[model samples]
Target: MGTPVAKIGLVPCSGEALPAGTVCRLACRRVLDTLMSGQTVAICLPLFIAGGEEERGFAARHPTITVDGCEKRCAAKATELFSGKPVRALLIPDILAQRGIPMPTRLRGFGAEEEAAVQAVAETIAQAVEGVVAQAQAQENQHGAV
Candidate 1:
């Protein structure tokens, strides 16, 4: 309720089905804290999907970045279904592949390598957040001019 619409919404995949899901969640937090700081807010995947209308309404009106744990893309799919718009989707495995890093297998504890992977995912998300903010600013500026 305290979250503001001006902040970019980060919807991380809530799939407990795999370790990749955990990766996305952790990476989302890292990006929010280090990269976005006060510029972003998280829309919990579980809550956003079946929680309340306020969240859905907020996502519909604001820019959202969906971080998917895998190809299923639960977060991205939910965002598009509820918000009626495509989000800036970042897939964790794909990010790692792009950097030529191997995917982690363990599901629980984040070891050194896992943490590094999370950082990589967070970095990619950070870059996307910058673009989202820039585009939002441009849209506001354009509307203000009109």
Candidate 2:
């Protein structure tokens, strides 16, 4: 096989697409936008929905940023299982659960309240990534000045 390309990946778990809901996609986009503000996020497009070939392609390239819409945490688990420690992870259900936002059997996108929940999750993940980057930078600075 050829050497994997290096890119930044965005992954989301939407719990098997529903009739006409776009919560997962929208939330994923928000997360991507936030991450993109700090780093390059290669548009991998729905990594959790892809199959073996596509999955391998994504895993082979890009440091992954995974976002899951449920407790199942499919995106994060897949990232850990195949790709190793994801650069970033957002657990949507965990975030919502923490905020006492119950998941409806059928989601019709997020309301203002739910949107806040999603933003909180994404922001938390973004902050974590920023922290990691800061630590890496600190280490680099120390080494460079040595």
Candidate 3:
């Protein structure tokens, strides 16, 4: 199949109420700024939740991943409410717990453990982006890119 490059949108929780939320933000930044800069972009959750037409329009076209902080899944819920379904959903707390990484209680007092969690989460997100892009391209090629 021919290579069909696809844009990926990352919507981070960006919640300041909890440290997991902060980790969500940092992990997304790692993806957008370092891991998948060329293939992915960050979608502002504040504006998206506020019904920003541009963000909504972007989601309509690209595959989006919702990076949530806790089990509440605010980011994922908001995205689903405004736009269509997200291609994938990530939870920082869940990831950290699954990886056996302990997290800080405060929102801004993260140390090395938090950093490590962010790194792990970012790597997973990057890999997910590649898979989504590749699958989209294969599907497009099969369907003749209508």
Q: Which residue runs does candidate 3 get wrong by more than 4 Å?
A: 1-5, 144-146
For model 1, state the Cα shift of residue 52 in Å: 1.4
Q: The CA-based lDDT of model 1 is what?
A: 0.81
Per residue, candidate 3 scores C-alpha lDDT tens digits across 1-146 of 44355679898988988877777888888899988999998888788767699998887677899998888988888888888789999887777788887876677866775678778788888988988988887887787955
Per-residue C-alpha lDDT of model 1 across residues 12-124, encoded as one tens digit per residue: 88568788887887888887787788878888767765766878977887888898988888888888888856458888889999998777787878889788788888899
Q: Report the Cα lDDT for residue 74, model 1.
A: 86
Provide the TM-score for each candidate, comma-separated.
0.88, 0.63, 0.88
Where does model 1 exceed 4 Å of error?
Answer: 1-5, 144-146
Pairs that collide in candidate 1 are none
* Candidate 1 lDDT score at position 35: 78
lDDT of 2 at 130: 61
